[model samples]
Target: MAGLDWQGWLTIGVVLATLALLLWERFSPDKVLIGATVVLAGSGILGVRQALAGFWNPGVLTVAVLFVLVAALKSTGAIRWIGDWVLGRPRGEFAAQARLVAITSPLSAFVNNTPIVAMLTSAIEHWSRRSGVAPSKLLLPMNYATILGGMCTLVGTSTNLIVAGLVHQQPGMPALRMFDPLGVGAVAAVAGGIYLLTVGRWLLPLRRSALQQATETREYVVEMLVEDAGAMAGMTIGQAGLRGLAGSYLVELVRNGELHAAVSPEEALRGGDRLVFVGATDAVRELRRLSGLRPATEQLFKIDDAGGRRTLVEVVLSAYSPAIGKTLVEATFRSRYNAAVIAVARHGTRLHGKLGDVVLQVGDTLLMETDAKFLRRYGNRAEFLVSNEIDGAARVDRPRALVALGVVAAMIVANTVLGVDILLSAVAAAALVLLAGCVHVAELRRSLDLRLIVVIACSFALGAALDRSGVAALVAAHLMGWAGSDPFWTLVLVYVAAVAFTELVTNNAAAVLMFPIAVSAATQLGVQPMPFVIAIMMGASAGFITPIGYQTNLMVYGPGGYRFSDYVRVGLPLSLVVGVSVLLAIPRLWPF
Candidate 1:
């Protein structure tokens, strides 16, 4: 250690500190990564060019472009159609898991898996209620299936592109073809899919969510108004689909300044009647979408722009929320937040009153009708514990769906057949979507996950620091020495190392750090680097053992009501299956 150069030791110190912070999980991943990058650059361990190089990396830019493309797909209803078509009504939980894996596996091979999981998570949450399946039983498998599928194609995951970019930096290494990892990756996907279907079902626990427990304790009391022009006008309560709504029931009907309690199921609903309901959040959510029904308060109408587009957002009031202790009307919530509360639910408590008269309280979950910018505007504020757009809140533009699909198809062809550079093709596809109005330029800001982009870009900087400071070479040499002359053990070591590190850090960071080591290890063994490269690629994505390991896993963690150990129980076996399959298949496909 004393013999090591200052740059090498500084790089090692910075990396170790960054790892400590990431493992602590006290701060955002992006903040921790960017902070580390700045420190390394400021300390003179890395030059400005090297520290900032990741921002321009093809992998980072490509991922940014893909986000726009995905948003376009979602805006046009293309993703929704694909999800519904692929996950058609299945009889039971096991059948539903099979359907999801079958569809997402192949779809992820061409499309980025993160957005796919994001798009599907909410839908699956909704479906879980309807089909009597626990989201716990479906979400983990859904996330894992996408990861396995991603392993099969070059463009499947940003991790693959990141690794390919590294490979291009090496002299004498040929650029990777689209399906280079397919043979091994597909086999592993199939093996893991089977294991999930057979063994994972029993391993995953059936746990009700906190929201569910809250609902069971007490139902939210909400008021809805029947609009004059809505098809629901003049229908009986029973005929309007308000009777026996899942998790909800009509409690009162107010019309012409008259209050009718214990309203009969057969009571006819008249235009402008204020119907009161007691139900769970899910039930309330369904009620909000009912045609001709509007929130009793007129503020909801104000959220609609001249373009007539509206989005539903969930805002969790914190101690700092301005509306705390103030009634919605008093807060002037419409003008204040630029959003209108359609419904409000306090955990395990129910309130009775007109919508506007109910005073806001800390910990209340307000469902607002607003635009996409709502997330960006209040997401980082201390006033709210959470501010996020509700997935599937808006109607799909079915007319634009085909055009979005065509643009995506052209992107695939341009990269796979026409040999256009992946980054350029992605940009061109993104432009086509924007120009065609699949996704408007105004919509792009919130559509991209800046945290994801920053983390990837910073990971590139860290990788550069590792390579330039010789830490990467030092680690690889020691690893090769530890494994001796055995190529098989060397490959397994690389894979195992990646999997272990990924559980502690970002998936792309794990891949970035391991790529140089894998390449060096192959060079030390006097063998082709492709096998080790493939091993690193597959292993970096194999983050099933913990929620922190993969972005998709974390995305579903809270929503699915999953504990940390839940992942180990179900994911361990699948990880083992994938590990064995990759080891056995990699040598044959990309021989050592």
Candidate 2:
């Protein structure tokens, strides 16, 4: 502090303020990081070129391209297909946990773990209902598994790519290979998986899920029709995956004008059969994703011209509407409003029977399927009081799923085997998917996570400031004084610091902030920088003690009915297990 210059003090202040703002959750991460970059560049602490260089970094561009690739795969249903194939019916909780770790850990190595977790959360909820297992027991472990898997490959997580990009910026440093972290990551993953399957399983709470709680309050009645050429036509109700739906139950089945109430699980389903379900709103939304089943109303197909580009919206009927007293069929609702009503609810009471036969009421809430533009078109119209589009409701293109899968495989081969750069490989894959019609340009634009890209690009300025202002070296000197300058002890301190920063800030930010300190520490010890680099990468992703530590953790917090203590109860042990394994393995793999 005595010898510090103005630039060093300014950089330190900006970094501390950034961490405080992020932890306070006052603003979005992108906004906070961008503001810090502006401050540094404006104060002459960093040049304009250095502040904006992150926007053009190879790692940042690669992350953006990968987002498009993941969106294309999701739109084509390839990721869901893989999940279904690998998660074939497990008998019990332990067996389910084992199967989940096996599939998610490996799959996340090749693809981004965030989308993988997002898609699987719903799938796991369905499985929990069918197997009579509480979702709270499975969701947290699944989140941890993805985080562990992400440590295996460079493309597995954004943190790894950001660290690699930093490494590439150094003089005389070789680029990191795809499997550079495999030795230590694989060992840590194995150790973490074992703890989850045994001790962590016992510690998980058995609280009711959010869907289960919602079922107790509000319920909606909806009907789904089986297609003549669909896969579920000849199967029994149980075999068709409709036996024990979570927060929903089958009321009856109608075939050729014959009514059968209290249908049995063994009852066979036939083409053109109407199955009535009474459940919560989430259950209805989940039913929409099932193959071979559609809303009973034919208007659903007639309203949206864009195939696989529709969303579910909730609209409340107002007294000024013309169809308040007439039935949906009599009012010609589809032709009049360009939307089809799939389900209706009135003051916590569930309506039953065919959607067309139901008479519209002034206060009834209607769940309709229409094009994405329906909200923009009719948001202000007096025909509806309130209109809101459901999130993650877009339809998938099953026909082009295989084409999207092929494109992803080709991208991996090109990067790992053909010796092409990852940025080029990702660009080519994104282009191929667009050309093959697996995902539309508009849909891709809507799905791209621009906020995440901005945060990654803007964070480079903070890292560069720390280096140029000598703050990183000053911190490294203090760390060496405390650790007695022993390479192993210094490595431990570096790893511990990274883990702490990640839990307080974010994974990518922790990596960027710790990169300069790690390099300075390695230089002071006269050791290869590779060990310290790998340590930072592993520690930054080992955020398991808190939900806010990782995005995936927060994603499951509500759905799993988890409290903050639940994470500590289950995650603290997992953090130690992974930490010990990584610390021991890094030294042997890349000696310091």
Candidate 3:
């Protein structure tokens, strides 16, 4: 063999560097991509002028804007409102929770899943308190639904958008439509939903939560007098329906003098008995109004507001934090942080805690209740991961929400009816939303994850380097040499490789890396390049292996209380099924 060119050697070095970084998990994939770009630019494999390609990639811009859109919906409390409806509806406990996943999954199809989970976690915790359902019962469904919903459209997930953009870049490639994945993806997603509803539920590792749902929502040690005519005077605890309080629960009952914290739900409640209810002040007010009761004048027990401005915060537990492997009781978040963790969501499992001793895991989301400024004060500490709350502070103008909704709708309609350039329409719509004051310029940056931006930038530069170095063609020729005479099997293998690579790296990176190979393979096989290019695009969009493979997966991971294997258990099989589905569809839909 002849000596390799400088570009070839540089390409080999780049690939080796990537492999070493990934093997060690030494840095975020974003860092890896950026580093690759810098290396290629320095080596002259990527033209200095081409280095900016990723910043302008339509796929990157689409994902960024979609993040902002989802953020806007999240800030509006729309997702939480949906979660509230799902959790509060009168239905069988499991059935109601299942309905929550069903609703959330489809909503994810239209919007991004991460912000959806951030908004819904709070609502589920609220339901856990009022309905006395284990938070563990609801969080898994939330995660599954988001993944399922991501299958609805090309823009539903960043991976899909990246793949679509890749196909658009190919000289002979066909342009993908908005609902390009609707047929196969929807079928797989719905099937995935069914899997979660039945088999996957059984496979989840159920951890008993630390927070026990008391008879009361959250008991405030308030004193109550036994009145002859009061509703509690003649009734047993079971008959009082203490759990039905809108915002609280009655956990302890005090009579004339004796205190009881272990009262059963079925215990009798009698009037004139000094009782203690673990409830918010407003709930107490409603209880008093409905029961016609008087407040105790003498201090009976310390009554703090039910979780004092209960807020849902997503906290990333850091490695150096005191909470790392310890339970809440051990961490003393209540005493130390002055916060009550109602639920802990990690991966696909939800662990409930009673402000007691539930050990924490890295990346676990503590569904907490505290003063608004309390957690914000400790946000920079090492103990907790960065937190994001769906802030509904901006006074939402109904007209603004309506107009924003209208713009997004118009863009979608235009794209579908007239085949308008989606990126152009969407960019215009985003501008309109900004001009209408729906979103400020300063807030836009936070909406999109910078990880995605870096990944795109790196992938674009890498693609250019591959084109310049001719390394992609060399690899593709070798791969094609193994195909022999049958074209169908080669195409299937190509798709499979793309999907596999996507599972290990960012979708744009997968596309950029694989597209050059796909094009080269088509040339060697003497076949239409469209089939191979489309196969790569389809495969790159598939992210049904690990939660780390996709941003949407990570979004739901901490909130779902899922272990790494939960996705492998459910997603691996679905991925295999979808792989075959794509293999069958691509040939028929776009014909070689």
lDDT digits (tens) for residues 1-592 of candidate 3: 1445978878878976775675455465667878888888888777777876777777777876665565445444444455555556645556865787678767776666655665566566555556766555666567667765775676666666776776676566677788776665665566667766776666555533323322133344345565677666667655665544555444356665655543555666666666554434455565566463577777444321333333444565643356666766466465576554544555545543232445666566665544555533664343443454423232345666666667767777877788887687677777777777766654565454666577676677777677668887777766766766356777876888787776776556777788777777777777877677657655776676786565455544564455688668766766676566667766676566
The clash tally of candidate 2 reads 0
Error of 3 at 267 (Å): 45
lDDT-best of 2 and 3: 2
Candidate 1 TM-score to native: 0.75
Top lDDT: which candidate number? Answer: 2
In terms of TM-score, which candidate is stronger, 1 or 2? 1
Top candidate on TM-score is 1
Off by over 4 Å in 3: 1-4, 82-90, 93-105, 128-142, 208-312, 317-362, 366-370, 373-399, 482-485, 529-534
Sorted on lDDT, highest at the top, how do the candidates line up? 2, 1, 3
Q: Write the per-residue lDDT of candidate 2 for residues 1-592, one digit (tens) a residue.
A: 6667999999999999999998765466788999999999999999999999999888889898988888787778777677666567988988888888877987888888877876677677667766889878888888899899999988989999999888889776788878898899899899999999988899998876544443332345667899998888999998987855654556557789765544566888999998867555566777787788888883222212223444656566654467888876588676566665656665324465455667876546665655566754664354554454544343456778888888888988888888888888889999999989888776677567777888999999999999999999999988889999998888899999999998888899999999999999989888899999999999999999987787777656655667778888998999999999999999999987
Q: Pairs clashing in candidate 2?
A: none
